[model samples]
Target: MTSPDVLDSYAPVVAEWYSANARDLPWRRAGTTPWGVLVSEVMLQQTPVVRVAPAWHEWLARWPTPAALAADQPGEAIRAWGRLGYPRRALRLHECAVAITERHGGVVPSVLDELLALPGVGTYTARAVAAFAYGQRHPVVDTNVRRVAARAVLGEPDAGPTTTAADLTLVESLLPLEPPLAALVSAALMELGAVVCVARTPRCGVCPLAERCRWLISGAPAPVGPTRRPQTYAGTDRQVRGKLLAVLRESHGPVAKDALDAVWGDQVQRERALAGLLEDGLVVTPAPGIYALP
Candidate 1:
């Protein structure tokens, strides 16, 4: 790992690079409301920024704040989550809105623990919302930040397949004081990892972290390798679940199982997927064999 003195040199450069090259994503702008930040972070959980932007705008415009969403039906929220792949996030968001209204007086909680208590708010999301929305000094380690931290600070070729609590602490140590600056630096590291210090083809020649990177100094090694390719959607249970859920989402009342059966013909696999969704609480069997969104 690079010593703190060496690591310090790269910070200014990263901050500069971020300021100049960061994408003009709506949620990153100054004066963005906390609710806007919360919505963007949630939409971005398993979805890409490019796809989340328009949906974020629509959600915020319609709901504007937690109370607005709290008052609306969950069906509207699910439908508003158009083409985001994982529609469950919309439902969780609706739950979060209700929680915020009842528990936090309709305001996004600034404290990390309070944020974590919200529905669908995991460790990464909690820290992200705290740091990004409230400008708090917390480790906001997403996949991008993890990759950057491993390479730049530890000289590692790649981060582990999943996050650990230690990873959070290490990243937190790198953060400077002044909450806004800390937030910016966390974003800077992520941006560096995303665009320049990429997974497959790192642009080390132009990378600001090059001078201090342990990986570069050690002669970057090949990564340990991904454990698996992305889970395939084709003919998978997720596809079947999406199909079944789509029908119920479109219809107001309970949908006959026959209509859902028509979506995916594989009787055995289709039944398994539907059962899984029901078990996951994403679907409800209103009556005997009739399904609807929960």
Candidate 2:
């Protein structure tokens, strides 16, 4: 059983550390709408802050509300995504906006289930929006938070590959009863993991919970087993997909199949990549052998 005292101890220190050290992200600022929070969470997936910030600013400025985005073409969203790597998120966000506009009357729903029902919204995103945007009490378990909990409470060097029901339960146990405080603590835990207690090299000296951390007490054992290698983008199908999409994004209308062929040399790999893009709905066939953004 998780101890209440141990969980309670994390609240004050995490909150204090966050107050002093948290990054001034636009979505975290006061008066940020639920729609803004929703966009940020989606964009942050597998993408870094340095790239997300400007794109986010331009996105919100162009489509400030669910209604605004819903009114635009999904192709526009894809075009505006602008080197964020995963273009599928653009399509999903556009669909989410349409859902919000139609179902929730242009407001981002506060209900967890409603948020989850939207296109591309999963468990983590649903909880994140509810906690961060609506000030609801929820256990927003991301990779960063899971790592923090693993090292600080479980005395483990890292969390497993994916979050589980057990992870949510542990996070719930650590949350404060008050919704606002719980939200702050949730954000603080994520921030702590992102900056101080990072995966590769943790800065234990600057960490607020270093003294109380169980992994630290256990001699900060090095990770066991083979480290997973980062996925390479160069010469991969993903690169071909990006190149194909870039052509469509820059073009005013449907691009000929021949135009796409010029972007990649290997016909087999290039065709596979373009087919994948079409399958993902990031590209659409406006006419025979002519591809355009959806």
Structural similarity to truth (TM-score) of each candidate:
0.93, 0.97
TM-score of 1: 0.93
Off by over 4 Å in 1: 252-254
Q: Which ten contiguous residues of candidate 2 have the minimum total lDDT?
A: 1-10
For all candidates, the clash counts are: 1, 0
Over 4 Å off, model 2: none
Top-lDDT structure, candidate number: 2
Query: Across residues 220-263, which tens digit of lDDT does each residue of candidate 2 receive?
Result: 99889987878888999988999999999899889889999999
RMSD (Å) per prediction: 1.9, 1.2
Error in Å for residue 106 of model 2: 0.9
Candidate of highest TM-score: 2
List, residue by residue over 79-165, the lDDT tens digit for candidate 1.
Answer: 788778788889899999999999999999999999998889998899888988888888898898889889878889888878999
Estimate every model's Cα lDDT from 0 to 1.
Answer: 0.86, 0.93
lDDT at position 73, candidate 1: 84
